[model samples]
Target chain A: MKRRNLFIFAVLAALGSGPANAACSFSNEVPIKVLSAAFEAWKSVTDAMAECGNVQASLDQDFRLKQSAAFAANPALYQLGGVANNTIPQLLNEKRIRPLNDLVEKYGQHLKPNQLIKVGGDIVAIAMMVNTQEFAYRKDIFDELGLDVPKTYDQVFEAAEKIRQSGKVDYPLGGMTMSGWNMALEWLNVYASLAGDSFLNADGTPNFNNENGIKALELLKRASEYMDPEYLVSDSTFVQQQMQQGKIAMANIWASRAGAADNEAESKVVGKIYTAASPLAAEDARPVAMLFWDGIVIPRNISDEAAEAAFRVAMEGLDTEMVQAHNDDAVWLIEGYKPGRLAEGAVATASAQPSPISYPMTIEMGLIHSAIGNQISGFFTGAKSAEAALRAAEEEYGTAAREAGLLQ
Target chain B: MRFRTFAAFVAPSLLLMVLFIAAPLTSVFVQSFFVTQPQIQRVETERCTAGFLEQQCTTEIKNVPVLDENGAVVTTTRFVGLDNYRAVVRPDRAFAALSAWDWQALMSIDFWKALRFTLTFTLVTLPLVVGLGLAIALAVNNTMRSIRGPVIFVSLLPFIVTPVIGALSIRWLFVGDGILTRAMEAWSGTEIAMFAQGWTIELLMLFYRVWHVAPFAFVIFYAGLQTMNRETLEAAMVDGASRFERLRYVIVPHLMPLIVFVSLIHLMDAYRVFEEVVGFRSQAHVISLQWLTYDLLQPDDAGNRAVSRASASAMLTMIGIVILLVPLLRKSWRDHKGAR
Candidate 1:
């Protein structure tokens, strides 16, 4: 009887491990490492990739700061890297990431055509999801207040004033206007919607010290009057929490975070929040937001065998199975993803007529973005006028461009 | 001690200092005088990204770094004396603002703004730390022997916490409807937003520094008080000197050296004020010199760092520290000579 018990235990152990291996088509042999931003979608993808075994993933919020240096090392630290539109230029310019055409031909048969990020006719990255900022509001509050969803900047201000008069929420509006990158993106979203020209001149000089820049700044200032007085320190997470806790009625927040609005475990206002396309800066312009896509890239400094194994594991991660499980985590580009209520805003924003532009993917855009982030806060802080702030940003960008050898 | 023994004793630390401190200092100094940049060329490139149902492609001129045959970006390094410094300081703009008596314009410049905050934060907090530390030490000394231990431990709690963690805790206590802010609102019968303006944030930062650093000063002064001249105090008391007079003359004079020592250390530490700015998220309103250098050195998304400008800014910070220390150093030097 004891011998039979031991045999049964051994069989049970083997069976218990069998299903895990069954989930992955192939048991990976080569050790593969990945570095990526820490987010819900990344978590889902990395967890899926780990099923193949021998995968170590480091998910960090500051992954952009570490990617270029890590990939530049000989026998690179990570075999796979997660990149977005704004971050891919550094790796591409330095040739730290490998071209994916050969890899896609070999292993990426299931990838959608739209998921291949192409630069100069070379497939360099594989996109998995698209993200954009969109208008999120409390439907119950709007209904009770007898307010309509705002469509343009003027309408937004009007709605905000009405909400303030009603005292329906702690603050009438919220924003992702934290200093540095978040603030800069907020400014750019409005500027892109208002301006009819490019951000830079043909020779790479800043083109934002014009009338559109002033108008964008003035609109931001006007909007701030209805927002929380401490909006300058509020990031996406802060704004999301404010909405979840019913502290604020509305905000233009990231599509990735819209899922949290209905998460019963954390949100006090579950099922009461609804999303819509971002409000326009003008009546005829596109949504006042920029589109961004997060994707995976293999590094150039790694061996071909490692790169192949990494690509296969990544493909497994981006497969339809993962999307079916995590469809609401992002506006997924995979085949099995079904756009739900949370994804409605992202879809609407993307399909708008005269669609919004993607965030620029160039070296000069990076410099100008940093310059604006550094200088635009002065205007909001009441330390500098809008024109002075714009001029300062231009001067700062000019200095950086000269130092970068992009200008004389 | 024998000369060989002394040399052997100091060799390891000397080697470490040279490797970790002096070498980097020399390299940064050299780098401040030079600029290195990648050779950038503009080229038209077609890029495609995912739209809702299809791929959207755009053709635009992009600035890309020229790469060599080895797949490495080609860089040109040249001697550009004082250019990086000029960029950081912007002496022309600063002078223009100064000549016109435009305080706002001068403060608009990053360096001047950081310098103003750093100096004020250091000088203002110096007296508070010294005074509060002395007060706490005296109070603890006067307490009963059994309860004194717990009092001292409780007083040291803020200092025992990590600097960044302590700053963050204080920020949470006062930031936007935090427990303390809510309480203050109830007490004052008005809404309070502690982080809404620059002066209030500065006030909180100053208060946090004092609260976090006073325990260190207290410990030193307490040790000095233990070695106080008991006979001198007794004589002063016997001569009908008042309690305040005895403290003012005897106890204070006894703690003078410790005060100067604490002040010197505090000045150096406070001038490098970075944690408060980060913890308070005060970059929208105020910044410090060290943060400015760090900001310059931080690479943007394109992996471009202002290395030369950061080095120049770092060197200027060190010079400012040295300048701030001259009077204290001279006084200590005189004291050293008098003792010899």
Candidate 2:
């Protein structure tokens, strides 16, 4: 009788292990097409999904803009696609993506409630990750210099200057000021926090030509002094390289790229980099970091059956098991996500700042973002004054707004 | 052959041309006259009464667009002929700025900025490309036969490269700690950002266009050299005409037709100028007419494309191309008439 009981226990344990191993797998019935950004987190998740069934993912470096055009032109080409938070309003306004409420009710029982992106009472997207620009620094260098983490933009400048004077590094600050979209975003991140409201006024006019705008531009220019001389061409990748190669002491970069600091293959200063919330502009102002969420959406033009299958695959891809396995790949918004070793810095960074604000998603806001990129180069190159740049930005935005039919 | 037989022989080519070229052009022309309106739908909202702890709100679903007659959604394309054209040209704003003598403001407009760059890029690069191509062709033509093959092969490499790839290669050489950039910095003891300002970026773009495109002109000029009259060259030489004089009076006149051909192709190709902007990432400083059209086609925050504006820009670019080519086309027509 004891032998029989032992055999029964063994059989039950084996059966239990089998289900857990194959739990997420489904039949390869329908082919699901996905368009996503070419990032490690997305790659790992998509690789997991591809194990379950038939999936073809087109991962691109510029997937956000490309997917928008793809969905607009031929939505049927993809059953599901990933888009950034700032792009959501436009896709929603165009009615290109379907409400995912029914799919959520059916297959999204495991999805977190906060991850459901609702627009006007309709569930449109299921967010997979939370992305934000956070402040990063060399902890070892800061400790060596007997410095504390900066809490405001002024403090950051002081820290950068101290580091520069110490003769420890060539430039203490690295920037993402590649003109056009990158530079525009920097202006927005600084000014939006200083303005403490929407980019536009209540009456839908351009509103960044005041004191706040000039101050933001001045602060940006001041920060440029301690940065690499080629900061105008510097982008996120350039900043990341600077940190990894120990060329700079601190920068506010996307949290998604923070993992590279600890990557032994790419980093010369491994285990030395730390992260904290982005610096503030003033005592009363908010954090200067820009908040963005990237998630998956199903275009409306595909068949319902296809949509259902695509959602199932995406859900399994974003399931708890996958998140746990690839937790360091991103700051996940899924269940079973505990801050990994690398994310400790990111968590500290986030907690130190004031509550974050979402990047503006209005069409008018997009127009302004582009207009600022076009006009701010003048100021950077000394072809225009701070006030002149602000005026030009406002005028350019006004013209774009009028052309987009957002203004008369 | 009978007229009917001759017509039958030309019918297929004409049909293909009409289907492929004329139809798309016509569609673009018509699309410029119409605009797509965004679809607006009513959404429910809630109002709450103020209270100490929390406001108790009652939800009421209302059809926002349905109730307001003037706010009705536009369901069909509307024809606003010439509106898109006006937006592309911005004539009123330009005129006002010009009246005020605000030259800066007038050039600040997107259309004017793009047009200025496009025109400058095309007109400035035209002569350099022609001169360089003719020079290379003359050099290769007079070379020893044994070395001619290798020289020709090596010279055609630049032209053989894809345009975007060539531009990117050149950009990488001079951008941010790149080999050439570092070398220059080391030598000059000063930093250089080649893509920083408008003039520098424009100069780099001009250099890249000449480098990448001169080889095509070289091959054409070289091939034209093979068919030149050796007897005329001998006569010019016997008359004690120098090599430069021989080239100026004999070879150039002979290569004029090919020069015209290459210039026409280059003008049309360079006037559009899309790939260089993309490869160099110069949209912050330099933009072309074709790039403006592409920028318009990009969907805005509403996911709605500016189709009418793109169409209008495209039409304007085509008009610019036609204007630039008018002299050459007229010369060709006159030459053909003289030949008859």
- Top-lDDT candidate index: 1
Which prediction has the highest TM-score against the true structure?
A: 1
What C-alpha lDDT, on a 0 to 100 scale, does residue A35 get in candidate 2?
Answer: 88
Tens-digit lDDT string for candidate 1 (A1-408) = 667545533543442322223467887878788999999899888878877766767889899999998998999999999999989989988989888999999999888999999988899999999999889999998999889999898998999888888988989889999988889888899998876337897666798888889888898888888888998999898899999999999888899988999999999999999999999999998898888999999999999999999999999989998899888999999998898887788888888887888887888878888999999999999999999999999999999889998899
User: Model 2, residue B171: displacement in angstroms?
Assistant: 1.0
Residue B236 of candidate 1: its Cα lDDT? Answer: 100
TM-score of each: 0.96, 0.87
What DockQ values do the models have?
A: 0.80, 0.19
Taking chain B only, the TM-score of every model is: 0.97, 0.90
